[model samples]
Every structure is written in C-alpha cells, then in structure tokens.
Target: MPSVLEIRWIMRPASLLVVVAAACVGEPDSSPWSVADSAGVRVVEIAVEPVALPVYASVGELEFTVGSIDGTDGPAFGDVGEVRSLPGGDVLVTESRSQTVGVYDRSGRTLARMGGRGDGPGEFRFLHVAGVAGDTLWIWDPIPQRLTPLSRSGRVWPVVTFEHELADRPGDLRRLADGGFVARTRFQPLDPLDPKYAESKVWTDSLVLRRLDAEGLEIDTIAIAAAEQLLREIWPSPTGEGDGRPVGAMLPFGTQAHWAIDSIGNSVVVDGTSGQMVLRDVRGSIRTVVRFASPPRPLPEAEVERLRRSRLDDVESSPFRPMVERVFSKELLPTAFPRVGGLLVGESGTIWVAQYATFPEEVTEWTAFAPDGEPLGRLSLPARFQAREFGEAYVLGAHTDEFGVQRVQRYRLERP
Candidate 1:
C-alpha cells in the first residue's frame, strides 16, 4: 500500500504541498499518528495535536462576490433546506416550508419555480434538493418516497421515477456524474442481548455508502464506517442513581461518519472517531488517508448549562412541556467535542474538513486536504455558512439572515 506521503503527487500539484513552517517539516514535538500495516490495509491512529488554535485574524482578510435568494419578487424561500450548484453558474434550492423548488442564476435572481404541496404528479409533501447532474436535478421526499428529477427550467423530468424504497435511512445522497448516484445509509446492528430492544449499543450503528445505477439498482457498496451512539434510552435506575429518561435528545454535532462523492464517483469518507478520512475508489479500494493538525476540545459544561437555560422559554411553550423537561437535564452532554463536524469534496479534488470551534467565530475554517491525503493548509470562508456543494470556482450553501430566514448564497473561492 502506498502511504499518503507517497501519494501526494497524484492528488495535488507540488506547489500546494510545499512546506511553509517548521511544523510541516518534521514531527511536531511528537508523532501525531501511529501507522500499522496488516494484510495491505493500513490503519493509522489519529490524535489531534494540542497547539495554538487557528485564528481567523491570521487567515487574512476575505473577499466575497455574494449572490443571495430571498422572498422579494419571484419565489421567496420559506425554509431553504438544501442548495446545489449547476453547470452554468446556476443554482437549485429546495424550500421545505413552501415545498417548492427554485432555480437561481449567479445573481441569485429566482429564474424558475416548480412544485408545491400536493400528492399529484411532480408534487411533494416534504421535499429536499438532492443533487444536479447535467441539466437534470433530483428532488427527494421521504413522505412520498419518491426521487423525482426536474429539468433546468423547473419542468417535470422526462425520465422514470427513481426507486427510493431504501433499505437504510439516507445519510447523504448525491447524483454521480455517470447518471448513477453515491449515497451513505444508516443501519442498526442487532443487539442479541436486548430482545426487548429498549436499549441500544452506541457502537452498533454503522454507515454504508453504495454506488448505484441510474435505474436505482445497487452497483457497489464503497465504504463502511462505525457510527457512534447518540440518543440512547435511559431507563429509570432501580437504585435511583441515574438521570431521567432522555427521549432521543440530540447532540449539538454528530459523530457519525460523513462523506462526499467527487465528480468522478470517488467516495471521501470522514471518520467520526478521528480527524481523518479515507478516500476510496468506486470499487471500495482505499486510495489514500488524510489527516490534519487539530486538537480535541472537551465540551464545556458551563456552555451546556447556558444552552439548556436559554431554551427555557421555548420548552415552557411547547405542548409537550413535561417531556421536554426530562430531555435536556444538566447531565446531557458528552465528554468531548465531536471528532469531526463536516466534510466536503471540492470540485478540484481538494477535501474540505470543517474546524469545529466550540464557540462562534467570524470565518468558518476548512482544513483542505489533497486527494492523496496531503495537508494543503486551510480554506477560510468569509461567513459562517454550511457549504453543501462546490462549483468550479464557487461555494454553494444556505446562510440565515438577521431575521432568521434561511437563504442560499454562492461565494467565489479564490484558490492558489
């Protein structure tokens, strides 16, 4: 197996991998990883370094060419759930509240709109933007269990309905360049000890992503990752020495493995347990493993208390006030920050790994990695936006405005 150190040239030009600091020349203070090779499968132990945090002030000033879509003239998005960039500087957005799809140009002007709340053809009850391939865009709704495609003009697609009787809940789904798709699914491992099925083992959850043909047939399962336990049931203790029942309380950030399929159908799987990811081919062979310099930070109990108290008004107003009271007690936080926050495979084959700062910051940071797993420094966005797709020279994502309206925006990413 070729080590990531040896695979750097295949994924990035030599200039991006040039050393800039002493930290990049030799092992920093200590070895950050432990490498082992067995049966040609290399497993490297990942430990985030304890170093000075990367500050936005050090990232220099940012310049953005902004484009936004809000409810002004044509179609104003009610709940902008997802956004994707198309080929011609165009964007597709899904409005969950309005249950509509809108197409916007680079200027963020709503050019075309389609679909509304209905059970009829080309309609959806609850919908989300899936992905765009060529001039066709796919929309998925779990309620209707349909994957419908639409033309660039927002017209109903001329092809057959995509089969979505999923064997697993979709973690992420994106259309592949070959009319196929790449998706990650969540699966629960059967616990032999728990026949009643009241309790769940955290390590039993797994994520599997597969490559599928355009006709909805599975081509290959490319990646499999172990998922962490979250939202476990806490029955009352017989000895009265435990917290109350936590009816599926969600974590602030997920520890489940996240992934993105590159333009050529390659899968980039980020491990939720470590600051690393394995880039693999469609055939499921490991091509390279990427790691970055990051340190793990424990969750601040004070912050947890603050957030819990901040929701007092909302909880008191909910109809299920009694249930809400038991959900987020003072003891509901994990010991450490989530291993990884988000992952994106850029159009240029640069992998973007989100920096999970415990507090709010000015610019969101992504530690970009070459496809061969070489660290290529960080890419900082001007705003705190959750980027969902990357175009040739832009980032497409949803950002909320001051009034709490989720709007889709695109910003140009000037890279070296």
Candidate 2:
C-alpha cells in the first residue's frame, strides 16, 4: 500500500554538527555520579541522593492572569494551547478554540490578537505556539500543515507549507536552539490487509523523528522508536478467510517511550521500563545516559482495575466497545508503575523530567538536570497547572479552575 509523506523547508541554512569526543571526556566528580564509556558513547550515571531534595519553599508569587468566565476584558478561552513569556513582561497565549494568538500585557490586558480560523498566511486552522527563537514566534498548524513565523508584535512572516509527498501527518513541531525544527510522525497500519501485518496478530506502531532546518527543509532523520505494541483481533472477510479486518488495542499500562529535544537540538529518550534517560547530542550521538536512584513503583491491582473500568465506561456507548472489552479481558495491568510521566526542556537548557504521580491529588515533582547531565534538584508546580514554558525568573503555563475556566498565569520564580 502507498503511504504519504510531506516535507517542507523554511528559514535558515543547515550548519555543521559540532562533534564531541566519542569517549568519556571528564572524570567522575565528588558527587554520587560516575562516568563511563559504553561502546564509544559517554555515560553520566547519576546516583540521585536517597534523601529527597526539598521541594521549593513556595511555588511563586502570582504575576498576572489572562482569562475569565466572561470575555469582557480578555479572551474567555475555551482551550489555552500554549503560553510563553515575552520580553518586557508580556505574555503570548495560543487560544486553540478561537484559532488565534492573544498577546496580553503584564496586567492581564489584551495587547493584540493575531490569527483566526483560516488557511491564509496569518490565519491558522489548528494553531499552536511551537517555540520562540529570539524575536520570531513559531506558530504550528498541523491541519493546513505549515509553520508560520511571527514577530513579537504578531506581524506575520513568510509561511512554510508542508508539501505532500507521501501521506503521513507531521506534528509536534518544536524549534531547536540552533534555529531548526524537530517533528514527529507516527506510522501504523490502518488497513488490516497491509502486507507487513498480513501474517501477524501483533503489530508494532512506530514513531519517526525528523530534523528540519529553519526553513522547514529536512535535515536528517533522528530516530524511529516503537510507539506501541498493538494486539490485533482479526475480523474475517466476507469469504471468512484471509485479509480480515484487524482491530487493534494496546495493553493497559504498557511500557512506552517518550522523547524531547533541548535548546541545542540534543535529544533525550525516556524508556518507561527503567526510566533512565538517554541523552543524545545535536548530531544524534549518545552523549550521556542519565540514571538516578529512583526505581519503578509497584502499581496496585485495585487501582489498575479501577482505571480499566473507567476506560470501559468511557467507551461503553461507542462502536469499539467490544474491541476495548476484548483488550481488557486479559487483565493487562503493568508489573510496575511507569517511571517517567513526561519530560520538558527548560528555556535555560535544564532538563525537567516529571516523575509519574500515583494519585491525582499528589503534586507532580520534576527532577531537573543541567545541560551537562548533572542533577540540579527537584521542582514542583501548582497542582493542575500545565507548564508550557519557563523563563529565567518565572514559569509560564495554564491553570484550569474547578469551574473548568482556563487562565494563562505567570508566577515569579523565587530564587534562593
């Protein structure tokens, strides 16, 4: 079967990859960290101190908020997609529901609203603030599929269109510190009769990571990792023989992997099994493998069943209910809890890895590592706050209240 792939090139020319030594370049420091070389790759194994680092004394002082129950002053945002701090105390917010970017002042006043629902240069069908590169604001729209650069004042620049080659959808477009872009596209067989899955009841779904220059041109393919291991239940064809329809579902709490690229285009891959983070440099070379003392926690069967039942209840009225039931009939709970829930790279090149929270009431604590793979400390955000960007002196994110009202808020970072 034929597949589609869309590739585009925009801003900046490709530069040379700065090569680091293929062997261990530094000696082990006095900390609980050790340095080693594994197959010519440097490894920094950090034995995180058992005594948990104290959480921040306080989250921070409230700076400003830019959403409300009524749209009188500012946007009564239905869904706030992204929030980033701008120079001189301004905030950039992407209101996805309205398909626009709203620039707000420090006092929660709307400065300017950019873009609306459209396919034109300044408009966006599915708008997201990809990242900020100096004075340029990157807006990503996977619907019409292009990257639009805008000034801090919301002035639109040349748009880079994703020209269709093969049919895979590219999304998660993020800007690297070197002024390039990284995106992810997933591949899985939708047709049961796909040649690769013809004789297999189990199919592997994979993720493709591609690097692009500032102009949206392909730089190099980074890595392809298994996104999911799906089990397919084949429904026979009209003749009741070959080429049956395959209905697939993943096992609950299965081990999965996630990745994030930092400012310098260095990538970190987090494997759910061990939770160890493998860091690769801009040239896609393994620079270090960051390990800590934390181990995977055991998940309780009761909680597992509760979650499984909750999932079933969600799809109870859907046509795929039977498939979901079949997927859950085998008690597919994981042996241990997932180690890393999510990962982020701060604006200052700090790697923030969110340790999986067991309960909804538990505040998620993130372990921070310096750009060089040294453990910095632990940081926590306000409960229910989704952090989208960080600054030298503040955290920029969205917080949804109990009334389901979303607000873009910034809090001052209190330094010791």
The most accurate candidate by lDDT is 2
Report residue 413 deviation for candidate 2 (angstroms).
Answer: 3.0
Q: Backbone clash tally for model 1?
A: 1
Cα distance off (Å), candidate 1, residue 258: 1.6
Residue by residue across 1-416, what tens digits does model 1's lDDT show?
54333343465544434432334457554544344564565554444542322221123222222233444543455776667667766777777777888787765576788989998778888776667777877887666557788888878974345565556656456776667877667655443335343563233367788777888777777888876544445456557874434334334334667777765677778876566788787688996665544556777877666655655566778644543454455444466666566787766676777766543322277666556554555566656566776544567676666666555666666655
Q: What's model 2's overall lDDT?
A: 0.68
Cα deviation at 340, candidate 1, in Å, is 2.0
The TM-scores, one per candidate, come to 0.76, 0.77
Off by over 4 Å in 1: 1-11, 20-70, 73-75, 158-166, 169-172, 189-195, 198-204, 232-247, 252-254, 291-295, 310-314, 319-332, 357-363
Q: List ranges where model 2 is wrong by over 4 Å.
A: 1-33, 46-58, 116-125, 151-158, 162-169, 177-179, 186-192, 195-203, 229-251, 292-294, 358-363
Q: What TM-score would you give candidate 1 relative to the actual structure?
A: 0.76
